[model samples]
Target: MPLAVGPYGQSQPSCFVKMGFVMGCAVGMAAGALFGTFSCLRIGMRSRELMGGIGKTMMQSGGTFSTYMAIGMDIRC
Candidate 1:
């Protein structure tokens, strides 16, 4: 009483393999695009402009606040 039969009532391996392959690819792409804590820190650290004192602080704070605002106001917590 299963619904996974091929044209001749044979169980189709390709059907399940295609579904698993699609899911695996989606998961792999998602994992690759994930930006976690260390990634955030690295992007922040590397984005500092070569300006000294207030200029440097301005650049860093701009990035920090941009990220904060982008992820902040939309949060429901």
Candidate 2:
């Protein structure tokens, strides 16, 4: 007996679609779990350094802002 093909000339069963969906969900969940763990560790380790760097950046920004304000005041006078 000859096999019948669908419109695309391929005979794919419904099981294949269900299996693919289940596998996709499993893979996505696994990846999300791994990434969440990694992100937690990454942030925990860098939190102190991040705060220090932010403080330094704020100081530098303040100095630059004061300089620009002075320049504007001089231009106005």
Candidate 3:
């Protein structure tokens, strides 16, 4: 197969494409984790105001579990 010419008519290596793909995935993972953390904090606050200590703890645990699951999807992603 012939190499594709880049914008400046130079041969472009596919490694840059691979690097960009990896970077995109890392950014996506970080965004998901950050959003999950924010959601967990919000849910924790609400649960604390509406329930007892045990209930609050349970909510926090659930939130953490979900966040972990999302972050753990890196390989699948």
Candidate 4:
């Protein structure tokens, strides 16, 4: 038996290349989202720990902003 070429006939190599590209893109997006969420949660936890015992005195005094900035800068690098 002989197979005839159709309108969309192509070689196997092209299909494999396309599949590899699609899979790579999906994996990269998933990894990036996971890391981004983890980093955000870490930042939130750090902020909460810093603001723990001080209560109203420090909140009204505006020292919280400095603590947050310091933590954020450390996380950036």
**TM-score attained by model 1:** 0.32
Model 1 gets an lDDT of 0.44
Clashing pairs for predicted structure model 1, backbone only: none
| Per-residue lDDT of candidate 1, residues 3-74 (tens digit) | 567798786544444444445444443443343324545556434332233343444444554445444432
The order by descending TM-score is 2, 3, 4, 1
* Candidate 4 lDDT: 0.44
Model 3: CA > 4 A from native: 1-13, 45-77
**Candidate 4 deviant stretches above 4 angstroms:** 1-13, 44-77
Q: For model 4, what is the alpha-carbon lDDT of residue 24?
A: 46
Question: Residue 45 of candidate 3: its Cα lDDT?
Answer: 47
When summed lDDT is taken over every stretch of 10 residues in candidate 4, the lowest stretch is 53-62
Report the alpha-carbon TM-score of model 3 versus the true structure: 0.37
lDDT of 3: 0.53
**What is candidate 3's lDDT per residue for 3-73, written digit by digit as tens?**
77899999764544445455555555555556555665666744545345444444455555544545444
lDDT of each: 0.44, 0.50, 0.53, 0.44
Candidate 4, residue 65: Cα displacement in angstroms equals 37
Which residue pairs does candidate 3 place in steric collision?
Answer: none
Query: Residue-wise lDDT of candidate 4 within 1-77, one digit each (tens)?
Result: 23345568852333334444455445444554455446545666456543442333333223334344444444543
